[model samples]
Target: MTAASLEGAALTSSPALGVIALGLPAAVLLLAVIWARPGAGAAVRAAASLAVLGAGFALTALALRPAGPSAGPPITPTATLPPATCSPDGGLLRVAASGFAFDPDCLAAHAGEPFRIAFVNEDAGVQHNVAVYEDAAGTRARFVGDPVTGPGTTIYRVGALDAGTYLFRCDLHPQQMRGVLVVA
Candidate 1:
């Protein structure tokens, strides 16, 4: 299997293992405590407590361990831009970025039309860039801009895109900065 599939399998299976590792010992200890006599020797009680503590620690560590590659934050578009007119030469889309968000989070363009974005980063000391993806999840990247630490502007060029809805986001702030590009 490919690496991604393996990762998915691991994520799916680890939780069950973690629950079993944690739950079985706890249940056994609980039953033992309820049934054992109060007068039972101190040695038995101490050993049982130690066993429970050790199992708890081990299970906690296992449950908290990081699973394979983390899928970044989910894509949720917060803004939409008006449709842009295509120039005779091509289309020019203007985007502005400030405070972890992009103005006109949505944009429109014609299919097979070359387009360029005048991306202005208005937030100083914040690094940002635009990346286009095949899906809203930002997993299949079509194009990526050179990251710029603002305040400044950069031109992002995209060749002809087929008719579909594409996703765009700031690579550094995917959770807070995301939008859609619709091609007709």
Candidate 2:
């Protein structure tokens, strides 16, 4: 993964959002209590409370801001696709991931030969990948490709496999993005 990918992880992942959303109010409240003294006048205490609320709002806004151009390298999806080499029976396969589901939700490839696939991730700024498992349970991997943050497309070079059906899914969201890979 690239540096931008690591940075994008926070925006796409839920844990980061949870921290900023929940932690901010707690922090703001703590500061309000510490800054507002019991001996202070009613007007002063009210001003401090308002200030704390404003600070929390501002901080949350900054935290939720989308990553800018300078955040890191950009991996934008492109129209150009990589070339593939395979038998006429099973050659290049195009697969796209979007809305946490794989289009077609099924794949086919020629067995006992090298396989090539053009994997495109349509979910912008969200990480997704096509992984071939030994079974539908995804207990094992026949081929696993590096995840790409979309919208972008990458190639997955899988080793030769015996003719059989295999499981394919997004490791990041296995339950949501999944399919079947049929090798013949």
lDDT of 2: 0.72
* Stretches of candidate 1 exceeding 4 Å from the true structure: 1-90
Residue clash pairs of candidate 2: none
Worst 10 residues of 2 by lDDT: 78-87
**Candidate 2 ranges with C-alpha deviation above 4 Å:** 1-89
TM-score against native, each model? 0.52, 0.56
lDDT of 1 at 123: 77
Candidate 1: pairs in clash: 80-106, 81-106
lDDT of 1 by residue, 7-118 (tens): 5444446675756665777767775774486776778777767777677667654654555322334555544433443222338888888877888788777788889989
lDDT of 2 at 110: 84
lDDT of model 2, residue 145: 92
